[model samples]
Each structure stands twice: as C-alpha cells, then as structure tokens.
Target: MFKGLAVLLVFQLTGEIIAFGSHLPIPGPVLGMILLIVCLRFRTSGRLVEDIERTSSGLLSNLGLFFVPAGVGIMAMVQTVQSEGIKIGFILIASTFLTLIVSVWIFIQTRKVVERHRETQ
Candidate 1:
C-alpha cells in the first residue's frame, strides 16, 4: 500500500511539475489524475493497481476529516461573517452558482467530445 501510494505521489508530483512548467490552467493534481489514467490504460500491473485502489479507498474514506480545517476556518470567521453577513452571503451564492454553471458547461463539452470520438471509432 505504501509503495503504491509513493508511486502515485511521484507521478502526481511529476504531472504537477509539468503543469507548472508549461503554465497549464488546470491544477497539478487534476493533471496527475489524468496521467494516472493514461498509465493504467497502457500498463498491465494488477497488483500495483489493486494497491493503488486500496490506498485511494483509504484516503477517500477519511476525506471528511480533511475538510475539518475548512470548517474550522469558517467557524473562526464567525465575527467577520456576522459583520458583512449579507454581502458575504450574496457573493458566496453568486460565485457558487457561477462555478456550478462553468463546471456543467465543461462537463457537457467533454461529454460531447467523448461521444464524437466514440462515434468515429
């Protein structure tokens, strides 16, 4: 498990470095995930894949714990929110809605491209 985790981290770091060096708009971790898929598609390593899956599952299982800090930070900002509550609420709602729209747009675009590729293939 540890070995697989290490390998995943290494590849993630490599992708992140490439993304950084090339000035990619996407985050490094996102690129790393893509790279992981590419690697999986090309390689035939059952044990390694299994290990990676196990490690990923473990990480995901405790994902809520990871958000604790964010929750804490929000709690710590109670006073600020209390002061600018209305404006903050409006801004958060607007930004969240905009993010959702953009994400949906990107998902639709990607789905279209994938469907086209599948049709051609």
Candidate 2:
C-alpha cells in the first residue's frame, strides 16, 4: 500500500513539474492521472496493478474527506461569494446544463457513427 501510494505521488510530482515547466492549461493532478492511466495500460506486472487498485480503492472510499479543504476555503471566501453569489450561481447552473446537453448530444452522435460502422462491417 505504501509503495503504491508513493508511486502515485511520484507520478503526481512528475506531472506537476511538467505542467509547471511547460505552462500547460491543465492541472498537475489531472495530468498525473493521465500519466497513471497510460502507465497502467502498458504495464505487465499484475502485482503492481493490484497494489495500485487497492490503494485507489482505499483513497476513493474516503473521498469526501478530500473535499474538506475546498469547503473550508469556500468558507473563507464567504463574503466575496455572497456579494457575487447570484451571478456565480447562475453561471454555474447554466454551464452545468449546457455541458450535460452537449455531452449527451456527442454521445448520441458517436453511438450512431458506431452503429453505422457495425452495419457496414
């Protein structure tokens, strides 16, 4: 478990370094997750994969705890949020629905394409 956690952290650190060095738009942790996925896909060691799976499961089991810091930070900015709350809330809600609609549309289109390909085959 400890080794798996260390490996994860190392990947995250590597990602942070790359992001900082390249000035990428994506977050370091997100890049790290991408790196981890690529590594997992190419890896042949079952033991390592199992360890990572176990570690991931443990972290996800208590994922809510990770949100505490964000919640606290939001509390710290309560005054700012309150002043712009309506505008912020509106944007968030609108963007969320738009994203959902766009995602569903893309999924439907992709499914149709796949179906056509299957039929042709």
Candidate 3:
C-alpha cells in the first residue's frame, strides 16, 4: 500500500512539474491520473497493479472525506453562492446532463467495439 501511494505521489509530482513548466491550464492531479492510466495500460507488473488496486480501494472507501474541504469552501463563500446561486445551479445542471450524455455515448461506442471483437473471435 505504501509503495502504491508512493507511486501515485511520484506521478502527481511529475505531473505538477510538467504542468508548471508548461503553464498548462489543466490541474496537476488530472494530468497525473491520465499519466497513471497510460502507464497502467502497458505495465506488466502484477504486484504493482495489486498494490495500486488495494490502495485505490481504500481511498475510494473514504472518498466522502475528500468533499469536506469543498463543502467548507462553499460555506465560506456563502454570500457569493447566494448572489450567483441561480447561475451556479444552472451550470451544475447543464454540466450534469452533458456528462450523462457523453457517458452514455461512450458506453454505447464501447459496447459496439466489444460486440465487434466478440464477433471476430
């Protein structure tokens, strides 16, 4: 688990360095996650993968704790939230719907690919 965490942190730090150096608009953690996905795609080490999975499962189980800071931030900006509540609500709804649509579309496409692969096999 420690090894997995170290790997995750190293990726995040590398991503932060790259993003800072390149002045990219994307968040370091997002880049780090993308990099991790790419590496995991081609990696052949089962032990490392198991470690990552174990660590990830533990983190995910405590995912709600991660939202506490964001909730606190929203409370801190209560006035701003009140003033722009409608716009914020609209954006959130719009984004949620958009995400749902995109996710469904991706799922359909993936299913088609899997079906085609099965037919070939």
Candidate 4:
C-alpha cells in the first residue's frame, strides 16, 4: 500500500512540476492520472501494477465519500442557492435535456454508420 501510494504521489508531483513549469491550463492531478494510465498500460502484467490496481479499486469503490465535503459546502451556501435557485434550476434542467437530445442524435448517427458499414462488409 505504501509503495503504491508513493508511486501515485511521485506521478502527481511530476505532473505538478511539469504543469507549473509549462504554465499549462490543465490541473496537475488530471495530468498525473493520464500519466498513470499510460504507465499502467505499459506494465499491465507487473505485480506492482496489480497492487496499484487493487489500491485504486478500493479507493474508487468508496468514491462517493469524497463528495460529502462538496455537498456540505453547498449546504453551507443555502442562502445563496435560495436566492438564485430558479436560475440555477433552469440552467441545470436545460443543460440536461440539451445533452440528452445531442447524445441521442449522435447515437442514432453512429448506429446508422455502423449498419451501413456492416452492409458493405
């Protein structure tokens, strides 16, 4: 577990250093995750990778716990939320429906292309 943690932190630190030095807009942790993915793909059969995978799986299984702080922070801002509740609610609803419509359209188009390709094959 300690070794796995050390590996994770090392990648994160490397990402942070790169992001800070290059002044990239992306977050260090995000870049670190990408680096970790590439490393994992390269060493898929390694015992160390298996350990890391186990550790990551355990953390992800309890990922909902990580959102508690954000939920509490939102609760703390209840008054602000109340004041702009309607606008916020409208935006959320609109964006959700818009996303659904776009997703369905894209899925239909993709399915059509796949069906056409199958016919050609």
TM-score ranking, best first: 3, 2, 1, 4
Model 3: how far residue 113 lies from native, Å: 1.8
- How well is each residue in 24-79 modelled by candidate 3, as lDDT tens digits? 99999889999999999999678999999899999999999999999999999999
- Candidate 2 Cα deviation (angstroms), residue 75: 1.7
Screening candidate 3 with a backbone cut-off below 3 angstroms (N, C-alpha, C), the clashing residue pairs are: none
- Looking at candidate 2, the ten consecutive residues that score lowest on lDDT are 44-53
**Which parts of model 3 are misplaced by more than 4 Å?**
18-26
lDDT of 4 by residue, 1-121 (tens): 7778778888999889889989999999888889999988888797788778777887799999999998999899999999999999999999999999999999999999999999999
Q: Return the top candidate by TM-score.
A: 3
Off by over 4 Å in 4: 90-121
Better of 1 and 2 by lDDT: 2
lDDT of 2: 0.94
Taking all chains together, each candidate's TM-score versus the true structure is 0.71, 0.78, 0.84, 0.68
Q: Is candidate 2 or 4 superior in TM-score?
A: 2
Q: Who is ahead in TM-score, 2 or 3?
A: 3
lDDT of 1 by residue, 21-51 (tens): 9998988888998999999998867788888
List candidate 2 stretches off by more than 4 Å: 98-121
On the 0 to 100 scale, the lDDT of residue 23 in model 2 is 100
| Candidate with maximal lDDT | 3
Model 1 vs. true fold: TM: 0.71
Candidate 2 residue-wise lDDT, 5-65, digit = tens? 9889988998899899999998898899899999998995888888888899999999999
